[model samples]
Target: MQASTLAALKELALQCARSAGELSLKRMKEPFTVEYKTSASDLVTAVDKEVEKHVISMILKRFPDHGILGEESTFAQDPAQFETLWVIDPIDGTTNYVHQQINFSVSIAVYHKGEGLVGVVYDPSRDELFYAVKGEGAYLNDRPLHLDRIVSLEEALLCTSVFWNKRAEQMGIDLIVKKLAGKVRGMRLLGSAALEMAYVAAGRLDGYVSLSLNAWDFGAGRILVEEAGGRVTTMTGTPLPYNEKSSVMACNPTFYEELQQYLHVAENTQTD
Candidate 1:
C-alpha cells in the first residue's frame, strides 16, 4: 500500500480507538450487564458489544471493503486471509471493568495481507494511547515510547494472564509463574493483555507473557511494543501467529534471551 494510504488508515484507527475508548469510559461509570462467554471468569459486558459494533460501523463507513474482527464479535471467524483487515478489542479487560472499574482498554490494528500497518491501544482510565505505524516509532500519549533498557529476569517486572477453563493449560501457567515469582522483581496479572503490552512499551514493565491469547487481544500491542524496540515471540521463541490462539513472550531486547531460557525451564518443570 502507498505510504499516504497507510497514514490515513492509521489516523482513522486512532480516531476509532479514542471514540470507542471514551464510550467504554462512559459505561464504566454506569450500570452494565455481564454475560459469561465460556465460564464465569471469561466474561462479556453489554458495553463490550456496544463499543465493538460502533467501532466496526465506523471502520466500514470509512472503508467499506476492509474486513473486521473484534473480540466481542467475529472472533470465531478466520480473519487472517483478508487482504485488508481491522482487528479490534473494544474492551480488553472486562472482568477488571466490571469489578475494579479500571484497567480496561480499546485496542485496534489495521492490517494489509495479514501484516499490521497501524496499531492503537487506548486506556481511557489513564487517558493513555499507545500507538505505532509499521517502520515508524511508537508512542504513549504524546510522548515517544522507548523500550530502551535491558534488565535481567531478576530485575524484570513481567505481567501475565492465567487460564480459567482448561485445567491442563492453567497448570502449565501456574508452573511458570511459580518458577518466576522469586526470580523476577514482580509478576502482575493486569487482566488486560493490551494494557500489559502497553506498559511494556512504555518501559513500565520489562516483559509480558501469556499461555494463549487471541489476535484481537494483542495485535495492537504487538506493533506498539515492537516499534518501541522490543521483541515478541512464542514462549519457545518463534514468531507469534496473528490468526489463532497462541502463546507469547514480549520483552525488552536485553531480556528476551534470558526470558526464553526461563520459559524453557518452566516448561521442563511442568513436564517433569
Candidate 2:
C-alpha cells in the first residue's frame, strides 16, 4: 500500500479508538450488566458488546467493503479473504473495566493482506493514545516511543498473564513466571494485554509475555512495539501468526534473547 493510504488508515484507526474510548468511558459510569464467558474470572460486559458495535459501525461507514474481526461481535471466517482487515477489541481490559474501572483500553489495527499497516490503542481513563504506522514509528500521545535503554534480563521489569487453570500448560506458565521473577527485577499482571504491550512500547515496562492470545488481543500491540523499535514474537522466537491464537512476547530488543532462553527452559521442563 502507498504511504498516503497507510496514513489514512492510521488516522481512521485513531478516530475509531478515540470514539470507542469515549463511549466506554461514558458507559462505565452507569450500572451495566455482566456475564461470564468461561469462568467467573473471565467476563464479558454489556458495555464491551455495545462499544464494539459502535466502533464497527464507524468503520463500516468509512470503509463498507473492509472486513472486520472484533472481540465482541464479528469474526471473519478468514481475514485473508479481505484485502483490508480491521481487528478490534473495544474493551481490552474488560475485567479491569468491570472491577477496577481503570487500565482498560480500546485497540484497533488495520492489516493489508495479513501485514499490519496501522495500529492504535487508546486508554480513556488516562486519555493516552498510542499509535503506529508501518515503516513510520510508534508514539504515546504526542511523544515518540523508542526503547533507548539497554536493559538486561536482570534489570528488566516484566508483565505477564497467568492462566487460572492448573493444567500442565498452566504449570509451564507458572514455572516460567517463577524463574523470571527470580532473575528479573519484578513482575506484574496488568489484566489488559493491549495496555501491557503499549506500556512496553512506551518504556514503562521492559517486557510482556502471554502464553496465549487471539489476534484481536495483540494486533495493535504487536505493531506498536515493533514500530517503537522493540521485538515481538512467540515465546519460542518464531513469527507470530496473524490469524491464530498463539503465545506473545513483546520486549526491548536488548533483552529478547535472554528472556527467550527462560521461556525455552520452562516450556521444555515443566510440561513434561
Candidate 3:
C-alpha cells in the first residue's frame, strides 16, 4: 500500500466529503426538484447532482491524472486505463434525505493499483466522520474504533436492506432475513449501505449484508470495516474484487466465519 498517497488522499477526501455534506445539509430544508431513476423508489434530487458536480470538480482540479467514478456523473477515465481511481457517492440515501433529511452520507474512496488506499464517509447532519487508511486503524471523528469485542452472532446487532420493491431478489433476502431475525438482537434497514457499513466500523452495528450494490456504494465502507478490525467479502464468502457488482457481507472479524457458514447453508437450500 502507498502510505504517503493514502495519507494524502485521506486528508483530501475528508475535506471534500465534509464540504459536500455541508452543502447538502444547508439545502436540506429548501425546496428542491426530484427525479426518478429507473423506478419510483430509486430517486435522485437536485442536491445529489449538485454535490457530485462540486466534488468531481474539486478532485479533478487537484489530481488531474486520477480517474473518478461518481454515482451521478460519467467517468472521465475508463476503468481499465487508470491505476488510481476515486469512487464517489455524493449523496447516499437520497430517499431518506428527501423525506427525513437524515441518514444520508457523502462517501469517497481512493484505490491505488486496485487496492483500497483511503476512505471517508461523512454524515453532515450529525457531523460524524468515519475514515480509514490501509494498514492504519479506522477512526470516527478522530476517535479510534475497534471491533475486537463483538464476537458472537447471537449477541450481534445487524443491518441489511431489503429490495422489497424489486421482486427478483426478494425471496433470497427474505429467507436470509427470516433465518437471522430471531437470532440477532435486532435488525435495521438504514436505506444507505455506506452509512450502515460505517456504523459497523464504529461498532454501532455488528454486521451488514445486502445485494445489488455497485462499486460506489460500498467502496469507502469496505476499507473502513477492514481497518476497524472487521472483514468484508461477497455474501458468498469470496474476496471482494474492486470492480465487481455484487452483494456485500461485512462484519466484525470473529463473527464473519460463522456468518459465512450460515450464508453457505442459505445458498445451498436455494439451489436444492
Q: What C-alpha lDDT, on a 0 to 100 scale, does residue 73 get in candidate 3?
A: 68
After the best TM-score superposition of candidate 1, give how far the Cα of residue 218 lies from its true spot, in angstroms.
0.8
lDDT of 2 by residue, 52-87 (tens): 888888888988888888887655355567889999
TM-score of 3: 0.93
Q: Give the alpha carbon lDDT tens digit for every residue of 31-100 in model 1.
A: 8899999888889989999999999889889987777888876434455556898989999999998998
lDDT per residue for candidate 3 within 1-272, as digits (tens), equals: 45666677888898899999989988886899999998888999999999998998888888889888888865655766778888999999999999888899999999887899888999998999999988888999999989989469898899887436253154465666667878888888888899999999999999998756888899999999999999998877777877556678899999898888877744543311
Residue-level error in angstroms, candidate 3, position 58: 0.9
How does each model score on TM-score?
Answer: 0.92, 0.94, 0.93
Q: Where does candidate 1 stray beyond 4 Å?
A: 74-81, 163-173, 265-272
The lDDT values for all models are 0.83, 0.87, 0.85
Q: Any runs in candidate 3 off by more than 4 Å, and if so which?
A: 163-171, 266-272
lDDT of 3 at 191: 89
Give the count of colliding residue pairs in each prediction.
Answer: 0, 0, 0
